[model samples]
Target: MKFFTGFLLSMVFLALASCDSGDDAGVPDKGYRYFPLAVGHYQIYDIVEITYTLRDPDTARYELRVETPDSFLNADGDSTYVVYRSKRLPGEVAWTYLDTWSARRTPEELVVQEENIPYVKLRFPPYNGQVWNGNAYNTGERDDYQLDSLGQGQTRGAQHFDDCLTVLQHDNEDFIVFLDQRKEVYAADIGLVYKETTQLSYCTQPGCLAQQLVEQGVIYKQWLKEYGKAE
Candidate 1:
């Protein structure tokens, strides 16, 4: 009888231990820090855009600054922050207003609207290989954005980030005809650190068909040059 009582106690202790392990393993990591947003926060990026056409390719270099200086409550009672975008030439001292956008964050996801098109930037508790439609809230065609990697280190130009993640927005290429690839990387506290987009159409002419000559489209790259909070 004593042996039986001791065995039962051992089983209970094992069950408790198992439950504790499960609780620890199931803790969710709400990765909201990767896209942190707040009033007075701003980021500056160096932009390089290359446009391809039947004529000579044109390249342009500029600096872009995005600032969040105000917020308002949307119809749904959720607070949405206003994003002000401005640009200046490489050596220019004055900035030209480009446009205004908006961004909202909830417990579940982050959404940003640009040119009246809303895009689901990232889903909460992001996990590697997770996929979702970036245009879920907009009228645009469906675009599957995937979190290709998470909690990884990334370096861009002279910047180094310890905790970062890469989102693969689109990647469809046919060297003979066309290419479309877009990706964005976000650091833990700095938001978007790097973005690259390439949309090109190859010439299908008999002579250039095999050469993979880019006939048209643009290649855009933006790298974070600095970030800070406005007074």
Candidate 2:
């Protein structure tokens, strides 16, 4: 009788442990905090763009400020936030309107519409090595975007972020002809901290075929300079 009672108690404990494990597994991770979007939240970034040409490369420097000031329901009845972008040249005091974009978050993914094109920017429960189609809703060709270095600390300029993740949008390089690479980094509470895009066409002439000399293309880099909430 004593042995039977002990066995029964052990079985009950195991069953309860299984139930707890199942409940925990059913709850999805809240990785969307890495790309937080809230009304009145604003971020400023320093932009440096270099356009490569046959002659010397042309460089442009400016500052971009993006803010979320309003939210509205989309056609699907989902809440969408309006992102307003403004730019200011160096030594300027006023910002010039650049453009407007929209972003929405779903249970499984986050979508951003830029220039009327919807892009799946990030998938929920983001983990290292996770890949998804960035142009899933657009008519563009299939583009795989991957996440890496999740929960890592990153330092941008003098600002240091305790937690951050990187999304690699595209990486295609043919050393002899062309190269294309794009990536973005986001902090836990900040939307975007750093973005880089490199597109280059190398000289394929017989004399420069193996030299990998860039003939024309562009390199764009944006770094977060400030972030806060508007009154």
Candidate 3:
């Protein structure tokens, strides 16, 4: 009887130890994994863009697929990723290559350029209310980007993400006002799960005294459809 009781106690202790180990190996603490950039990491997102004009508002919806094909040496002799992006409008049979962009991720920030304009997409160790100059490299205009909030739970498609992030970029000039807002959600073991971007350009007419709606605005939303990692 004593031998059986000892065996039972040993089993219970082993079970408890296993449980603790499993918990430790589970999800990690809120680390700097908000954006997972790796070679061969690919993500497909459904994009919807809307543009406002004086005559009529135009809505153009499409699908944007991005994949990190390979890395190349930059001027600083560091490996920079070359992201290949493609776009396909709804009802289109084939996808068209949009452009090849370069991205570099350092311990501080993820720097990317779109249409020859460099911008800091994200900063490390994301925290609420953190502000940065997104348009630091832009000569035309400067924009202020801030982490509006964190831990915003969001669901996209069949997957659900918790503790998502929301960032906002806005700028105001003497006559023209621009705002480009974004909400991005990341998932463990995967890169960007969901993202949404809204851009607005408002200005007043020259003759009119008050601010007139010259342009309605534009909104772009993207969701993860499927992903395949390159080995």
RMSD of 3: 6.3
What would the per-residue lDDT of candidate 1 be over residues 36-74, giving only the tens digit for each residue?
Answer: 889999999999999999999999999999999999988
Q: Write the per-residue lDDT of candidate 3 for residues 1-231, one digit (tens) a residue.
A: 999999999999999888778644665554356666678988878877788876677877788889898897778766678889999888887879999887777767778777667788777777888888887767856567888777677788776777576666653332355655666666555657777766666765576424645476777777888887878
Summarize candidate 2's per-residue lDDT along 1-231 as a digit string, tens digits.
999999999999998888778545767667878888889999999999999999999999999999999998878877899999999999999999999998999878999999899999899989999999999999999999999679999998778999998999999866778888999999997888999999999998898996979899999999999999999
Clash pairs for candidate 1:
none
State the C-alpha lDDT per candidate. Answer: 0.93, 0.92, 0.73
TM-score (all chains, Cα) for each model: 0.86, 0.85, 0.71
lDDT of 1 at 8: 100
Ranking by lDDT: 1, 2, 3
| Cα error, candidate 1, residue 69 (Å) | 1.1
Worst lDDT window (10 residues) for model 3?
171-180
Query: Stretches of candidate 3 above 4 Å error?
Result: 1-31, 75-77, 171-183, 201-216
Q: Give the TM-score of candidate 1.
A: 0.86
How do all the candidates rank in terms of TM-score, highest first? 1, 2, 3
